[model samples]
Target: MNLRVEQRALAQSDQDDVVVLGPNPADTTFETTSTEGAYKILGVRPGLTISVFDMVIGADFAGRFATEPCVAIDFLFEAAGQGWLLDADGERLSSLPYRPGRIYIMAAPKGAVGFYDVPVGTRFKGMDIRVDTTLWQKLGAGDILSSLDEHHSLHIASGNGTWVGVLPVPPQLLAVARALFDSAMVENDDLAFEARALDIVHASINAMRSIQPAATIPPRDRRPLQRARDLMIAELSYPWALDGLAREIGLTQKRLQTGFKAMYGYSVYAFLQEQRLLEARRSIESGEVTVTQAAMNVGYGNPSHFSQLFLRRFGVQPSRLRPSETGKYQEAQAR
Candidate 1:
């Protein structure tokens, strides 16, 4: 393990310390300590590295990493504040809102600098993995790397180029992350660690490939679609028709349908249905409304039909999510 510490002024007569640990690929166990918290890199394999960090900041903090030539995937499991990354020229690359279920992929060449900042007293928990391109080639995944290079927008500065983007973290990928974090508690489970790490790497690559390129709408054409989406979300109970919506948005029906499908990977009605079910689910889970009421709130007049669609989408009946009222009713009956 390689360790380095840097100190910077926080206030008058006060300083904040930041420490980073770089472990060898062959090392099975790696750990680091700082004033705020402890960090661990549990599973280290050739061509891949996995790390978990839990820290509370004492002051405004920023750190930079000089990364090797590789592709890095970062999953933010829990965070209480905001953060951003800077490119080699000290320009901000992107706004990274630190929230649960956020993931980012970075394809960087040698000597790339990664800058991160978080405000004081913010708690952060995350895991990151880095895989070298040569190792990917040796594993017969050269095509995956090539595809990322082709599809990703490159950020070139000072003769270095990096491709980076935020990805949607699906439930399947979250399950893998949970398993990996749990595995850290078991001692001497090298094989298990290795298997979980490989699972994450493969899942990341698959997620990248599954991204629908055609669904990416150009910036200038996005405002009307966003307005349409917002309107749908805001008025869940409103009876919506494609032609009416197109006229309201000053678009033809065909253009509206085509743009909705191309931008969201779903038709307008399909997206509306998804949003209705999701809102109904939230209402039921909150226990403030009955299943029928929740259904009706989302424009479903037939309770039976709503229940069927809800079960199909969420794999459970809406009533199952509602708070139990049986005990109170039983008490009243006995009295």
Candidate 2:
């Protein structure tokens, strides 16, 4: 899921709290200036690297962050057994491990972010990495880049920070033992260039593994709720008014409404709307239709209606719900 995060720092008088990014209530671009605080977010991810395997192996990271000049401090962090901390001249000062339940923070000097080229080969798997630590903390620290499984995570507290480099991994062992060809082998290798590459790959995999699984509540046995849901999903050929669906399912509209709420955790109408919006997103992402066409195909006679629903469901407008857009939406949902 792709995430479009917009943050506005609160005034100094008020304890600063970064506003969560969501559907805006008024006519305001995310770029609008707010004296309240600095704003930074991941606007999009266009798959800068081509192949899935390449993304997994090389672990190329692309993102942005904002900082407060005076308050921010420059620091570098690396993982030593899951904990990460500031790397002060090759020595670990803090232990910021991969805690599953809590978010850890790292900060960098204002306006400084380190950029590096990570060559992830095809052997790495993106879904295997798990870094549940909130990306917001990472953003606050400056841009973060590292591998998933291996503790070789890297952090730049700001633009002023220097890299401690990718975690230790072994590359030369590839030719020695087939068993040493895994991500662990790479991470455990000599603490050099080849080893660093393996660490990057490991970090990426760990990150992929970190995301929570999709919600899987038991399906409702309630007939009307099930029937209404199935109909809405199966046939999106026409406008789906709530009354018709309730009637078709052989239940009073009220029963249908309450049953759906009890079972799906959303009202029947809302569930149906989500269904149509999801379909429209799929259509737009596949390049099978233009934004306008996607709206119409999903039974939204007016494009504005489609955009609003899309924004509500995925936190972005339908106009931006194409392939790259969909990926960002999906990634954000994972967070």
Candidate 3:
């Protein structure tokens, strides 16, 4: 394993937490902890790193944090605060609201800085998998890398530019994350984790590819698609038909279908189903509702059919996501 670990203090203050896991320049696996929280990073192979961060901030730590430019795919499973990314000249590049179940891809040039300021008691939790350009090339994923380069100016070297792209955390990607999280708990073999981490990187690349031929929507067409998206999000439980949706958006059914696919790379109803199931999973995991209730809330009246769909999407039953039962399904699979 080409692992390397180095630790450094974020600032001179005694209260500032030191990266228990040294800031690795290459492949490494380490865990860090402080009064506020803990973090673990695993980078056992070339061109890939997986990290889990759970932290709480009591004050502004802007001047204390820094990072190298790299591509990052993030799954924000839990968060209760806000963060910001700043360019070398201190221009704000992005404002990150720590919303649960949100996934995003971002590339920051080498000179960029990131910091978070949360209330004294706010908590944050997320998983980040970083893959460098070297790995992209090695995997023969020039098209995927090129897409990012073209869309976000990601090809620009450090200090030149930065880019961020946000998308819903797809069910398939979530399953990979859950598997990685589970492996972290019961698997001590470095090879095992490395394999799983690589799987994650591959899945991330494919997720980007699956949303192919990214194009900008003209304002005239964008408005109606945005309206339709907003309506679905606002009323997931609403019984929606293709004709009704197109009429409400002042477009013919065929036009709406074409425009929706062009804008989102998914059919109108397909996107809605994804959103509904994602929301239902979140609701079940958060303990805000029972499995059946979650199904009903997402417009599924038949609990049995809903459960089957949930299983198909997430590879686990809705009940498995509850806090008390988390990972039980994975354990059963292992057996």
Candidate 4:
């Protein structure tokens, strides 16, 4: 999860609440003129950082961001639109949308590049936690350190190496996030900040523990069905329309759909989304993207969605990821 974030300065106005997250070279920040958004990045402890944000899109948005290696826990109170994890070549790697009212935990050994375009009037409110707390065999989960069992998603290797887990926000954590977003706490106040921040990490670890890995299924029918699967993997962007795919595999459309569901555990359309996300995750972790020309990399393509209006609004164009100067390292090395 390459979190595209901002640093906030908020104020009340006559008509609407104004949020300004101007560009600053000191810490991580993402800025755009068209969107009305709020963001505040606060340092909770030496190895922990938390950001509170709320925004409403003014145009279709597409951009990329970079980060230092750390675990990302995102709690979205309100959200719209979806994001894509893109690889070094600007191709999408993953597209598992952790929906609104849920917390998304992404454990990355290194930083990544991501692309997403929110609609012209959609809204977003959330808190992002960057973690490198206590260590458990290089895993930087605080409080719950060694309590994680083997069933935890981190213990299992995923298709693209990184693990993304989605969990409903516990009430205790939700209260804290809402308060932070509402600006109920003073920026400089350090009272119980570490404890609150660690609370989030602890909750994330517990939620992650409950996520069991999917059981691997053997090939159901290895002849034409296997051939069909291979073809899909080879050209993920190619629209493997039901009629064409079925004819190529010598099976009826119904048989092909049924066979795909039985073999891959998803419909043909869903499988494409799965593969695109996997490929993107692998590529995103490979390096940093220049962000000179970020394009929409979803399964479907339309000219209007990725238009000049979006580019002018965001002023970002990340084309591909390259080797980052800040190389990967152990959990606590940077701090």
Best by lDDT: 3
Q: Candidate 2, residues 1-335: lDDT per residue as tens digits?
A: 11122323212213244222221212243233221211121111110000101112223221222222211111111111132232333343433322111112223322222222223232212111111224323434113433211122222122234222212111222112122223222332322323333343344334333432212322332544555765775676567776787778887777777666765556766766766765676567556688899888768888887787778767666655444544443334544
Candidate 1: residue 334 lDDT (0-100): 42
Structure candidate 1, residue pairs in collision: none
* TM-score of model number 4: 0.50
- Comparing 2 with 4 on TM-score, the higher-scoring candidate is 4
- For model 4 the local lDDT of residue 128 reads 79
lDDT, candidate 3, at 67: 50
Residue 114 accuracy (lDDT) in model 3: 61
Ten contiguous residues with the weakest lDDT in model 4: 12-21
What is the number of backbone collisions in each predicted candidate, taken in the order shown? 0, 49, 4, 17
True-structure Cα RMSD, model 1: 10.7
Off by over 4 Å in 2: 1-221, 323-335
Instruction: List per-prediction Cα lDDT, in the order shown.
Output: 0.61, 0.37, 0.63, 0.51
TM-score of each: 0.59, 0.33, 0.67, 0.50
RMSD of each: 10.7, 22.3, 8.0, 17.3
lDDT of 2: 0.37
Candidate 2 global TM-score: 0.33
In angstroms, how far off is 323's CA in candidate 3? 6.6
What lDDT would candidate 3 get against the real structure? 0.63
lDDT of 1 by residue, 226-265 (tens): 5686578668899999988888877778878887788666
